[model samples]
Target: MSPGDEHDSFGGVGGSGQTRTRLPEGNSGDVYGGARRPVRSSRSLLAVVGVVVLLVAAIAFANRGGGDPADAAGTSPRKGAPAGDPTAATGVRPVKAKTGTIPTGYAHDEQGAQSAASNYAVALGSDGMFTAGPREDIVRATHDPAVADDLVKRLDASYSADFLTSIGLDENGTAPSGLTFVSRTVPVGAKVLDYTETSATVEVWCTGLLGLAGAGSTKPVTSAWFTLTEKLTWTGGDWRITSSSQTEGPTPVNGDNRASMADEIAAAVEGYGGFTYAR
Candidate 1:
């Protein structure tokens, strides 16, 4: 077995226009797009964010009234909660800088905290956490320097070799031939549990897909609902996760949508890219 254990991951922003194109008649090249699913990649995964998804947690926002945006430049909390709509984009550009593939350099305020929590949750829940190198980069990027090393160690133990095998992945966290392992966290909403000038606690309610996507696979990808709570501090001019935990949903009943086939799920992950939310 390769030497390594534990896990960590987290970040993002932006939406670019996608134009739909109709396929021209072709015998093979574009016919059913060659009838082959696109390759699976861990770098692109999707999540939808909303304030309403938190259920009762939405009401617990910091009740403080307005204050100066300039005041937030220091370690003091910004005046008032984030704008009227919790889901509305702040018009500020999402963080474009990245540590490895994780987004960084978020604004030092509420939107930053919320974006950090949501993106970190996605990273923590990604298939990369099942591997080592990418996992370490994710942990270090999302966490405070003081705790990042410890977190990397703890996470290594959490994603043990046995755990990896039980989930139909190799020791390196790669799925068997022709199979795709999917583990993605989609943040449904973010809510401020508490906030200070230099620190904040945010809950990111999320839905995720996990398991293997391929025929003959023992573990078929499955969906889950939960909330990821992150304690964040303004560190190095950006929000870094100080500590984190998770709890069961806030889940809603599944509507009429039927579960897609393994190939279909794999295709969707490939066709649709993820977002770097900045609300």
Candidate 2:
């Protein structure tokens, strides 16, 4: 790092999924990893990449439907009072099937919109977004027929060779031989930001895990929170993402526990299947 270059740390702390990077002062090097130099000027890189978490991409499931789970219309609360079920599962699976790990098909109603947004948040923030093959498929699944091609091209450019290297990944976005590249999003909750018969805007609050996990890995796996806003439309018998964006925070203070060793963290991530998340 040069003396004149400014060091600004960009991070997100939400309900569970994102990455936060800190660039220390005093002749310290890049924020991404060890001695590898940044591929572009720090400011331009940050502005262009939006720190991956905010990388302007959308994720969607394949279209498949059998029995759609529509939200049963119910009376609203008397004026001035608010009403909602922020966290609860219907004991019903929202989608009939999945494409790879991505779920497919959703009802054309408010509940389904919330479910789609929450699940897509997970896929968009997943490790798959870093690699080429899966990235293309993910965008395809984003399923906005009008924009899929453009999105694929834009995403390819975003996760470029230099960007991958800065984060200690290879051309294929694979972590160094022994390290496990981890990126997963856990949606804390979802809200119907806006709704219409054929379209809806939903916000998914997430706490995500990201980075390389293994001994001697500079980018040790870390977790943070952020919210993803997805605009979706009911198309081809399912809900598809039309567009999306992200923002940091509603963050909480750090906990007292010390940071875990790289190996320990990796083990926990592997051994634990994870907690059940409700709609």
Instruction: Work out the TM-score per prediction.
Output: 0.70, 0.70
Summing lDDT over every window of 10 consecutive residues in candidate 1, give the lowest-scoring window.
54-63
- List model 2 lDDT by residue over 77-177, tens digit each: 34753344534446555566566656667766787787677666666666777778987786667556665666677668767787677667888988898
lDDT of candidate model 1 versus the reference: 0.55
lDDT, each prediction: 0.55, 0.54
Top lDDT: which candidate number? 1
TM-score of 1: 0.70
Best-matching candidate per TM-score = 2
Q: Which regions in candidate 1 have their CA more than 4 angstroms from the true location?
A: 1-85
